[model samples]
Each structure stands twice: as structure tokens, then as C-alpha cells.
Target: MDLSGKVAIITGSGRGLGLAYGKELARNGAAVVINDIDRASADGAVAEIVAAGGRAVAVVTPVGTSEAAGELVATAVETFGRLDVLVTNAGILRDKVVWKMTDEDFDAVIDVHLRGTFTCVREAVLRFREQGGGGRIICIGSPAGQRGNFGQTNYSAAKAGIVGMVRTWAMELQRAGITVNAVCPVAATAMTETIPFLAPHIESMKRGEPLPAIIRRDVGMGTPEDAAGVIAFLASDAAADITGQALSIGGDRLALWSHPQLTATDFHDGGWSAEDIAACWGQTFAGSIESVGEEFPEEVMPK
Candidate 1:
């Protein structure tokens, strides 16, 4: 946790989870580079860090672009002298179902989440390699990437792509002493406040519209601080051996983020027919429904 003279660049550090991370890193002795599109918030964050006896500078730039990412990295090296840790925490949500989703929505989300991570990490990787040592690249991901949400197709795809990018980058950069990882964070912010619109719809429900009670239970739940601890760990020396892993931080839980595991997979290996695929789907659904136990009962949805 003693970052000391290490230079860290955090995207979207003006507010929410990114702000929390900047505060923590600065307090711990790292000279931080705070990046955000909003000049005011970015300046305010750096000022707070300075007021608290932490060295930091604010950079106003759009991280979704490669040029901006390079500029951000250059600012860190030029101002503080070296780049050591990078936390790509900038993102936006443009939620919509597949059919209702616009290309703009999909593009924007991917540009900010997936492409932004790529741009920033690629820029930092060069410095890490040139220095002939290890560095940390922490990308922000989401639970929607692990478990699909109804109206978050764009966000989910972008987040999932982030995990893929981290995994690939980890292997590609391992020899260069650079480690890449991801954190699937759940925070209470502007993004979560829109969840009422993202909640799943059940057409088969005889009750027609989804009840207000069910919707209320599922949205806007975790706090920004909940995500900071995990990001801090990934950005720390303690996590040096851990790379290409996706960890989830939400509420009171911290665990590895993973995809669904099937009882039997690889139907393609044996060349399954249509009937085999249909039967597999039927068994999987039945088993899954029963496995949920009381977690997903009919009364919750009300037939």
C-alpha cells in the first residue's frame, strides 16, 4: 500500500468509484494523475488530494480516444516522471434491449468501456516495457457482463469485452513484467439509478405489469466505497502474482467473477443432433429452476 513515488493514472477520477480510488492512492503516497472530461471535477479532485498532502494533477481529456489516452500517460510521465499503475475506471451506460438499442448506444458504451481500456492500457504498456519491469493495469468491469441484464445489452457486451481484453493482454504482456486484471464493480451512482428501466420483464406473468415491490428490491444497491477496496488491491504490490483474473466487488461480498458452469458441455465434440440440443436445454432449465429453491418463487412474480 506504500505507493511512495509511484505514478498512477486513473480515468474518470472526478467522481464516484474513480474519485474514491484517487483519494485512496493519493493518501497512500502515490503521485496520482486524475483524468476526467469535466474540467471542474477533475481540478477539484486534484485540489482535494493536494489539500490532504498528496501529490496529484488533474487532466481533462476523453479517455475513449487513443490520442487522449496517450496524452494522459504522457502527462503522468512528464509531470510526475514515471508511470507505474493504471486504473481504467471511466465508463458510461446506454441501456437498451437488442431490438430497441440504437447503434449509437452500442458504439458509445463500447467506445468508453472496451476501447477506452484498450487505449489507456496500450499506452501504459509501452512505458512499463521501456522501464524493463512490472506494472499494473486494472480495468473496470460489471456484473452485467457475468449475468446478463435485460436492458443492458450494450453495457454488458462492453464489460464482457473488457474481461476478454484483460485476459489477452495479460498473456501478451506477461513477459514484459506487466500484469492485466479486471474488477467487476457494483457502485451506487448515476448509472445504477437508471435500473428501474433496465429491470427484466416477464411476459408470461398473468399479473401483466411487474410489481413495484420486485423492481425496488434489485436496483441502486451498492456504494462507491464498496468498489474501491478491490481496485486498490489490484493496484497494489500484493496482487503482483494475480493476473488475467476478474474479481467482483459489491455490497459486502468480494469474489471471483465467473461465467456459468454447466453440468455437461461440449455437445459439439460429439456432434449433437437437434434433438440432443433441445433435450439438453430442457434438462438445464428444469435443474436450474429447482436449484434456485425459494430464491425465485412464483409469489415473487405473482402468476
Candidate 2:
């Protein structure tokens, strides 16, 4: 899709998936603002994009703070004339079991992922309204959030919260011509390389080698470009009617996630006592209740 004359901002865009998104958007003719906490990394991204004959500017600012987020939005407008898209991809991970997770760890992840996304979207929407045009807001989500993973309580909560924000904003801003969506991407990035079992495969992929059969079967190996393509599509005009969606992208796979909804319910005219409720609980709810690990069925997962 042609994004000529469009102005877009991508957070944490100095490296990883964010960098890939910025490059792709810029390559598509968008004037991109690269936001990152590291000045050198941000400058490097801008230099690379410019070297490739794409327009891009670096804005070294952390995303969680209101002032910084506002500045990021302001920079895009000042430098590029107007803003058209805001991609919230800045995030951190502090993995630990619930019991071992400290308040600091929990708060840090939430601050960067959830709060940061909120601030950036809020700021961008204000500009979008003033500009009197529709805009796109793409929030980054994680599989850990959709289905809880081991030792990632903080990360999961923050990512899940992002999906909620996307849904709420999508409804609230529909009339304003603003679309909000979330994407859960599985790719071989700096973050995925941390997984012990996936490290060797990730390294091999980096060296342009094929992944092992077992690793390829269990978790399809994909690069940041795989995820960037999906995000770019969501920002294009073709996706104007598609909002409030939680989409997954990995390898050649694309899937839509179902939102939470009522599965089974027991109704009592007055109110059932503890013993009365217990009597029908097994038949009404027990059969539908899923056991641990059932979420990832053996049929779909690695044998």
C-alpha cells in the first residue's frame, strides 16, 4: 500500500521488531519518526533509512512519560507536517512466577508496555482529531498475554492490558475516524532469542541457515519482517474497516483471536444456596472447565 505523504511514529524503533516496522513504513513512502530511548540507536536507524533513500528522523524519548509522549507526537507534526499513524511497540520483559515477581518488576513492565501505549495513543489521537483526518493506532501484543505462559506474569498482564486498551479505543474513536488494533507477533527477535531452547535456532536463522525440524515444527521460525508486514497492512487504507481486532502473525500463519465471552451459565430465579449451587456445578460447569495445559492441545503443539 502506498503511504506517500503519510507521517508515522514508531516507538522503541532502534532495534528489533520496531526497527523493522519503521524501515518498512519508510520504504513505503511514509515520513517516519523513530522514537527510542537510546540516542545512538535512534540515530543509527535514521541514518540507515536515509541511506536507503527514505525519510526518517530520530526522536530520543522514553515512551511511558506523558511529556515525552507528547514531545514525540509534536516532533512528528513539526518535522513531517502531520501524523497519520502511531505504532506502540515499546516494551520490556521481567519474567518470573507470580510469587517471585517483585512489585518493581511488575510495575516496570506495566509502565513501559501498558502505560506507555496509553500515553502515546492518547497524544496521537489528540493530533488526529485536530488534523481532521482518520489515523491508525497499532498496539503490540504477545502470545503470552493471549494464553498465559510460564514465568511471565508481569509481561502477560501488560500485553493483555494493551489488547483491552485497543478494543476500548477502537469503539470510542470509531466516530472520530481513528482505528485501533492489536497484533500478537511471534518472531525471531532479540526477545525470542532469550528462550533457551530457541537460542541455537535463532542464532542459526541469523546466520541465514535453516532451523531444525523439531524447532521449526513446534514454533515456526519467522523474522521481524514477517511481523512488520502485518503491521504495515493494518496501517494501510485497506484496513480502515478492520479495527478492534486481536490478530496473530508468525511465519506463514495468520489467525484471529476470539474475545472473552460467556460460555456456560447457571440461572437461579431467587438465589441458590452453597449446597444448591454445588449440586448442579459438576454438570453445568465441570465439563466445560479446561485443565492446565489444555489450552495448547497436543494436536496443535509439538509432540
CA lDDT of each prediction against the hidden true structure? 0.79, 0.87
TM-score of 1: 0.83
TM-scores, each model vs. reference: 0.83, 0.93
Report how far residue 41 has shifted in candidate 2, in Å.
1.3
lDDT of 2: 0.87
Pull out the clashing pairs in model 2.
none
What tens-digit string does per-residue lDDT give for candidate 2 at 1-303? 899999999999999899999999998889999989899999999999999999999999888989989999999999989999999999888888899999999999999999999999999999999998799999999888888778888888898899998899999999999999999988888888776656776888978997654444445457788778888898899899999999987766677888988778898878899988899999998888754311432433433
Q: Candidate 1: count the clashes.
A: 0
Candidate 1 worst ten-residue window by lDDT: 197-206
